[model samples]
Target chain A: MIAEIASVSFIGGLLSLDVSAWGQIMVSRPIVCGPLIGLLLGDLKTGLIIGVLLELIWINVISVGAAIPPDATIVAVTCTTLIILTESKLSLGSDFHGSYRMVVLALTMPLAEFFKTIDVKQRKLNARFVHYLDREILKGNLKAVGKVNNFSLFLVFLRGFLFSLVAISVGVYILPKLFSYLPYAMLVGLNFAYRLMPALGLAIAFNTFRGL
Target chain B: MQNLGFLYILVPVLDKLYPEKEKRIQSYRRHLEFFNSHPYFANVLVGIVARLEEEMAKEGEVKSEEISAVKMSMGGAFGGIGDSLFWGAWRPFTALVACVLVIIFLGKWEGAWLGPVIFLFLYNFLHFHTRFKGVLEGYEKKTKVVRLLKKMYYLRTIWSSHVVGLTLVLLTGLVVLFRDWEAIERLYFLAFFLSIILLNRWRISAARLLYLLIGISCVGGYIF
Candidate 1:
């Protein structure tokens, strides 16, 4: 369990870098990251389902201009990780697994906003690096250019790594316990919600084109 | 933050163009100024700036202020276009296509992995093309690159993607209805879809909607 958490966190850290710090490649998007994490945890189906769900839900959430949208990547990573890991740990019959997934997704959804707050704070801290580089460049220490950029990127990676490490560590421990405690009625409700999730995602995706 | 990235990209170019330490410092200072643009399209500006710097170094004809002006104007322009075309249109289109593919073939076929593969391949094909080509095109054509961007019919692309994306979304809803869902389930799915679309008009956040759905489901479960 510990090894699984650590490895997933490492990949989470790297993928989070693709969000904005290093590559703006769409790999950071939930569609890619979800399944990637899923494949790592040996659950491609859950990963694909969760990835497509999150991708559609947050399809319109883009960082345009100065507005930083919620960190969908973090939510997708943590949500998929929790579902796969916790589902494996639980002895719940296959019948209840669908409901279990919905419950995990619902609970994990808020992490995107939480991670966004942290992301904003990190970007604010990065401004200090710019000032540092300004000073170094003015001093004819041109080499600091690469150093500062690399250092900032490292911080971004470290932030994602540490966050995912702590998030998955805590989530893996708690989620299954919570799901186990839920009443049968709530589980059924979650199953319904789970089936309805794609509708929500599609609606949001449709709303994105409302302007056009 | 992007300023730092911009400076990092231009370092080797500056190092080569300005051998004198003092001149190199000036060039570095110029690039180290604030610069933010769409990451992929920024390469276009980078290429243009690199060419401008080379000219400034060799011929001393292009003024530093003109270079800054070009950076400011083009940065804003390219940022807008890139955001709309890539982030707004292209990403959603490719992702929706992948998602629909996943929904249609996930359990029924062994080709589910192809969804993400196709997504990555389709997206990065254009992404890398722009990233690699934009630089060369910008370097070769300079400001005339704007003319080339205009010719790409970005608006047409954006409009078509949105249309196709809508169709795919509808198609996905239909697929789920016929394949996995039963009679009551189909009605519930339609109701959820319609309500979600209507609720979206209220500008409710996705998270809130998710929670709301979960809350409602729990109540429905308890009652029925």
Candidate 2:
């Protein structure tokens, strides 16, 4: 379990880097990272389902200008990791198993906002790098430019790695325990909510075209 | 900030063009001024600036202030177009297609993985094309690259993508309903869908709606 958490956190760190610190490739998008994490954890199907759901839900949550949107990629990574890891721990063929994904998703969704706050702080800290480079360039230490840029990228990676590491570590310990305490009635409700999730996604996607 | 990024990208070019340390530092300082644009499209400005700097190095005709002016104006213009076309339209269109593919084929077929593959391929194809070609075109044609972008009919693509995305959303709702749902389940799905669409008019955010739906579900679960 410790090994699994560490490996997933490592990959999660790299994927989060794609968000802004490095490549802006759509790989950072939930649709990609969800399944990627799923495949790593040996549950591709759960990854795909969760990826598509999160992708649609946050489809319009783009970062325009300095306004940082909630970090959907982190949510997808954490949620998918939690579901796949916990699903294996619980005994199979249970009545509540089917709705487990929804419960995990509902609980984990707020992590997006939490991750964003951290992300905004990181960006604020990055301003110091610019001033540092400005000073170095004035000193004719042109080589410091690449070194500082690489260091900044490393910092971004470290931020992501440590964030996922802690989030997943704490989540793996807490989620299944909380899930076990849920009554059967609540499980059924979550099942219904799970099935209705696509509708919510579709409606939000439709809203993107609202004024068009 | 993008200013630092702009400086980083121009470093090699500046190094080559200005061998004298004082001149090179001046060129570096020049690029360190404010710069921001869509990441992909920013390459075009980089190319243009590189070319202008080369000319300034060789012939001493182009003024430094003119280069900054070009960066400011074109950065703003490209930022607007790139935001609308790529973020507003192209991304959603490609993402919708991938999602609908996932909804339709995830369980029934082994080809479910193709959704993400096709999405990456389709998106990056245009993305790389614009990124690489924009630089060359901007270097070759300079400001006339704007004319080239205008001829690409990006507005038409934006409009069509939105229309297609709307259709796909409706199609996904239908498929989800009839796929395996019972009558009661179907009714519940419809209720949630309509209420969400209606709630959207109140400008409720997606995150808020997410929590609200879950809250309702938990309570309804306890009752029914």
Local distance difference test values of all predictions, in order: 0.86, 0.85
DockQ of every model listed? 0.75, 0.72
For residue B158, model 2's alpha carbon misses the true position, in angstroms, by: 3.2
lDDT tens digits, residues B1-224, model 2? 57777888899999999999999988987888878888889999999999999999999999999999999999988888777777777887888899999999988998898898888988888788889998899899998889888787556776677877888899888988898688766888898888888887788766788778777888999998
Which pairs, if any, clash in model 2? none
Specify the highest-DockQ model's number. Answer: 1
Residues B13-73 of candidate 1: C-alpha lDDT, one tens digit per residue: 9999999999999998898788888888999999999999999999999999999999999
**TM-score, candidate 1, first chain:** 0.95
Model 1, span A108-137: residue lDDT tens: 888888888888898888888888877888
